[model samples]
Target: MIPLRAGTVTEVAVLGAHCDDIAIGMGATLLTLARARPGLRVRALVLSGAGTERAEEERRALDAFCPGAELDLTILDLPDGRAPAHWDRIKNALAAFRAGARPDLVFAPQRGDAHQDHRVLAELVPTEFRDHLVLGFEILKWEADTPAPTVFHPLTPELAAEKAQLLLKHYPSQAHRDWFDEQAFTGLTRMRGVQCHAAHAEAFVLDKAVIDFGGS
Candidate 1:
């Protein structure tokens, strides 16, 4: 187990296996980070595959959600549903990120997820970046057991609503599924809010926070 702490954070590197993962997982936190810290740069990467044209859909979706921060996105054109199949490609991607830029903060999915892609991403991230602060975002599902988040942020009802609208409206293929319905989105937010004793909030599974305890 890793002890967690909070400190000044500026940069963010968001890694996802599909288009909607980042938005559905940690969209509000990304929103909060941008607003709190001016001139913060976000690097959003998608280990995309051919499942549903994920390469293009997410690029436009992110543009709509985070309007101010121009997305420094890297769309990895790896085979979808085949992330585990190509170990070399995944490693190369992680190595390239480390070799180029080191973000102060990292956000990815948790290992408890029901989705195979999400689980693999969770495993891959820790193996690559060992020292930076990492937060795991939740994706609602029947298998989302023991959801624990020590770092929580309240999202305005309007912001939460807008996020759902973005997820549903921007990704038309997703809205066709009932899971992306307004009720479903609201209910998940409500549940997380209840856990954190807030009206509405986004939760992050915190780990390995690199904070300077000494007075600076």
Candidate 2:
């Protein structure tokens, strides 16, 4: 288990392209923070909020997963599958949103994701959160794009199960989608667990050297 120095996440900023992306990519991390530092405040920001059942579930699931935490989820109603084309609007809007506040940590999609929307959102995060420590998270989907993850988070099989359960239970609209299954998430953790020599694990690829070994 790579203990994260996410810096006592009293302030956190999470950005996503659509919905449920945050929950899927970093749900267990949220659970860990929510339990570890009960007072840590969290905020989720989405570029757009379109009227889809999938979108609605994300709102509800986030509340369920992190009850009483400050959550500012902004789902930009920009057309799905067109994030790259709207770069100026997204960059300016994210800049405006992040102007006064500097979060302790920023979690967003990996820039190398094969998904177009994810890639666009990933690019926008660095532009706005220029100084905050940024960590790229992966989502298992049709692409199954697994980049070389340098940071690994160890979770109990139970914690992994709970994370998966939250994903399955809270995001009902996405139930039809097979990957939303707890089993799939659990399976990936199992595989990652092997790499980290743990019972379960979630891996992340850092874009830069936030800190060297032992805060060197």
Candidate 3:
């Protein structure tokens, strides 16, 4: 596979509709980038679970996922599974976030997500961050919604293992879910790895990209 290199990534923006969505979808990618760019600035926004144990879990989980990077996270009080009703709140929050800083990359959900909340947030992300490289991460749920990703970030076994371990460690609230176990996470990573010819990987969908080959 041909490698597509991104320019120096000093800052990144990660958006999630729920507490563990970011970690489950693109935690390995975050880990890879954070390790590659020490002191990387990560601005993360989650639309729900604010003022609850889930929010706390998200804060601690992101800290661990990003490692030494500067992590700025906001967990909103938006109602769970009801984002479509609060369209203004979601849009305004995204616009405000876009106005604050310019990031090298943005990680968000794809519009094809099965969950209503995730699909709405995904639809709103591009409206604010136009002209930015947006990589849509996928969440493996019981719903038949995972799409074929156009991009892949292969992860080493150790790094993949660490991501699974971190998910299991920081989010005690999610431990009850049957699909939240180590085997499920690792299995998905392994399957993605097979697609990319790596030991493990996290895949993402690129809705749009502008490649420059000026010298050619």
Candidate 4:
């Protein structure tokens, strides 16, 4: 893999279909970025779970994931698993978010995700953030729809472990789920790390990018 550096990313945007999707998909990466750039601007949007405990869980979870960063989160009350049906609202919300933040990098659900809510949001992201670098993050679930990721963010064992702990700690509502455990999170990170020749890592699908080979 040819290594490409995302130079001086001061702002980032993350989109999720549900409350814990961002943390599940790229918690370690957020941790890495926030530490590297203190007071980094992070804008997050979740389509479901507004006015509920799940939304509260997401607020705490993202704050923990993005330590020391300037984080702004929005949660909506759109029905879960039915994002495609609420296409207009989703599109409008995305447009409003795009107007508010000009992020250097955007973390969003991958297009190939099996979940309908996730897949719909992924499809809508590019329409709003047309000129930005968007990284499609994979969420481990019961479905066999993980994308073949083209980019990898290698993580230290300590960072990976910390991500898992944060996920477990902040989202008590998800603890009952069998897959929402440290072992599963660490296992996926370990496998991705093996693929990328690291001790631990997070993988992402790059839908598109404009590389500057000769720039500073």
Return the clash pairs for model 2, or none.
47-76, 48-75, 48-76, 49-75, 49-76
Worst 10 residues of 3 by lDDT: 207-216
Better of 2 and 3 by TM-score: 3
Q: Write the per-residue lDDT of candidate 4 for residues 132-155, one digit (tens) a residue.
A: 999999999889897899999999
Q: Give the Cα lDDT of each candidate.
A: 0.75, 0.80, 0.92, 0.94
Lowest summed lDDT window (length 10), candidate 4: 206-215
**What residue pairs clash in candidate 1, if any at all?**
49-80
Candidates in descending lDDT order: 4, 3, 2, 1
TM-score of each: 0.87, 0.90, 0.98, 0.97
- Residue 15, model 4, lDDT: 99
Q: Write the per-residue lDDT of candidate 3 for residues 111-202, one digit (tens) a residue.
A: 89999999999999999999899999999788889799999999999988999999999888888888888899999999999999999999
Whichever of 1 and 4 has more TM-score, that candidate is 4
lDDT of candidate 2 over 1-216, digit per residue (tens):
446555556878887887888888888888887777766677777776666676688788887767657666666687778888998988887887787456788888998999898899898888878877888888888896887887888889898998899888877767787667878999988888898999988877788764567663
Query: Please, what's the RMSD in Å of model 2?
Result: 2.3
Off by over 4 Å in 1: 1-7, 50-52, 141-146, 210-212
TM-score for candidate 4, residues paired by index: 0.97
